[model samples]
Target: MLNIPLMSNNISEEDKEVLADFIRTSDRFTNGPKVREFEEAWSQWLGVKHSLFVNSGASANYMTMAVLRELYGPGEVIVPPIAWSSDISSVFAAGFTPVFVDVDMSTLAMNEDEILSHITDRTRAVLLTHVLGLNGLSQRLLDELDRRGIPLIEDVCESHGTTMNGKKCGTFGLASNFSFYYAHHMSTIEGGVICTNNDRVYQMCRMFRSHGMVRELTDEDMKREYAEKYPDLRPEFLFAVPGYNMRGTELNAVLGLNQLKRLDGNNARRVENFKLYVKNLDPEKYFTDFRMDGQVNYAFIVLLRQASREKFERLTELLRSENVEFRRGTAGGGNLARQPFVRKRLPDFDPSTLKNTDFIHFYGLYTGNYPSLEKEKILELCKLLNRV
Candidate 1:
């Protein structure tokens, strides 16, 4: 039996050679060809003015929130509870409180009503995650945010190629973060990118991602330094805003650049795989596909029928016996919001405020998407999972 896990890194040999060359050189500084090339490629792909590479998606999210706080500090970030644990922690790490909102189970994005209920004068940003590659959002929400003058920071970690009303998910917000973890829509081993059109955000994020070092200066900063010196601008590797070491390696950047080249094809494969799963699986046996139209699904995800803990174990054991892999669900349970650490840190916001989180823990699991598994393998896996 073939051992098909949740994900497989499909790194081409052609890409590996590119990474090997950058690794032998061993210089992450200077904003080299690979770095800029990656940024340029992603920027063009997402149709944004700037894309800043970072070590991980969590770092990208943290840096983005830090940049926001620098521009307008000590604010609140609204996020959905029924989602990845990273989305919540990153918000708190940014020195902003995370206001938990419920999810419309069908969409798995933020619940519009719950979002509005949480917003206040302190609410400065809304972090929207295109959960599981399904983009279930309406333009009405964008309009509401625009009217309120609050910025939207899209957490496009799960959704790289998803669209809403013909515009890409990552480009809709003022700034966004993308993950390239092994199981994501795409992978660069372990790397992430932050995208934004605002020059200030881009420069600040670049500096923040690299411990406040600005190798690639925006025009405004160059002019400021030039005014201080005579012929050439003096070096100012000074700390502007306090930052972190979140820079991506040149080797990883090369990998990401290669992945970026085949993103459309890769996501297309995921979309087709999702259609197959939905078409083959019993609609009554499983809940509806937690997918929205136009989503380039990152995984063939679903919600299970609510069952007893013992039955759950039996179900998983049965699948494992069949050599079919399944995910451990996305939501953080037991130790997430209720644990001593989170309770100590976030005592003000009651953990019970996120009721939907518990539901997410039990029912959610994905047969994560990857390009390596052929269509036949996927069909077999789903056929076994959909058994009555």
Candidate 2:
């Protein structure tokens, strides 16, 4: 019964018309030419050498981890404690241990210095999520990871169109994941993409997306090697690695192609809406000074200046009474360490280690900020939030 929702379907009627036209005109639908076309278009847009269309953002994450595991065997992966469950789960699923780090209060992203201190010889990669469309990366962080010969995997699922130093967020990492769910900056119904400059990683992702078939790989030498290794097996069905069928459909690609055209424009609108929201917010009650350099606005995140259980309860009640739909925590099932999935696995895990993450877990909330949201609506939302 909420009047204001956390997400409005981003897919436009024009995009729907494109889908209808595609369905009527196209002969093949699932994982075909349109998917490849969309992947190429996305790679060009993100300034990456290659991109793979997948079933979901989580699948892109898991597939990236799987490919990395294949390249370098299981080891410890440094991850932010305040990320989506899949960011950590993918590490475990790929047989790697997740080493959690606290986040910076301002950016709500991993503390760069803390991440450096946490790295060890066993560290295979550093999986960083650009929390809620904010660029969490710094030159110092990238230089250190490079110096240490550690791979940087970026979870840019919530950060489409975000940039750092004139470079797109997804382009900086060894591999980056993006989502095109109905609620994201753009929509493909239910799809995601993995972007990478590494040819080996790109080829691996292609094979991984389609049941590990060698036919999907573009490297002729690698395909020949696999063919020779399994002469008895059918060449088309040659399984090069253990992988999942995480392919996206042509229908989804059609939506993505149309939606991608509007992503930047929509992002700009969202950014303007965020500025208005922040300007009108009551600073005494909320933490409004978010780091904005190289940031692309996603949601209207409101973090309380002080954390209190009673205040949080009151805020939620106020929001409910005002018919404002909001998510209690930030991105990806907030403060992942506090989730039951992680707590049960690491029974003795101390939540105090991630104080900033804990603060967000208890105090943070976010509402919708889309291109369709008018400036007046944003002002109203700010007024409502200030009253809380």
TM-score of every model versus the real structure: 0.89, 0.97
Best by TM-score: 2
Q: In model 2, how many backbone clashes occur?
A: 0
Give the worst 10-residue stretch by lDDT in candidate 2. Answer: 1-10
lDDT of 2 by residue, 4-120 (tens): 778787777899798899888879998889999999999899999999999999999999999999999989999988778889899989999888899997788999999999999
Tens-digit lDDT track of model 1 for 72-175: 88988887765566777777787888777777776677787788778899998998878777885778888888989889999888888899877898998889
RMSD of each: 3.3, 1.5
Q: What is candidate 1's TM-score against the reference? A: 0.89
Error of 1 at 330 (Å): 2.7
List runs of model 1 lying over 4 Å from the truth: 21-30, 213-216, 221-235, 306-310, 331-340, 348-353
By summed lDDT, the worst window of 10 consecutive residues in model 1 runs over 330-339
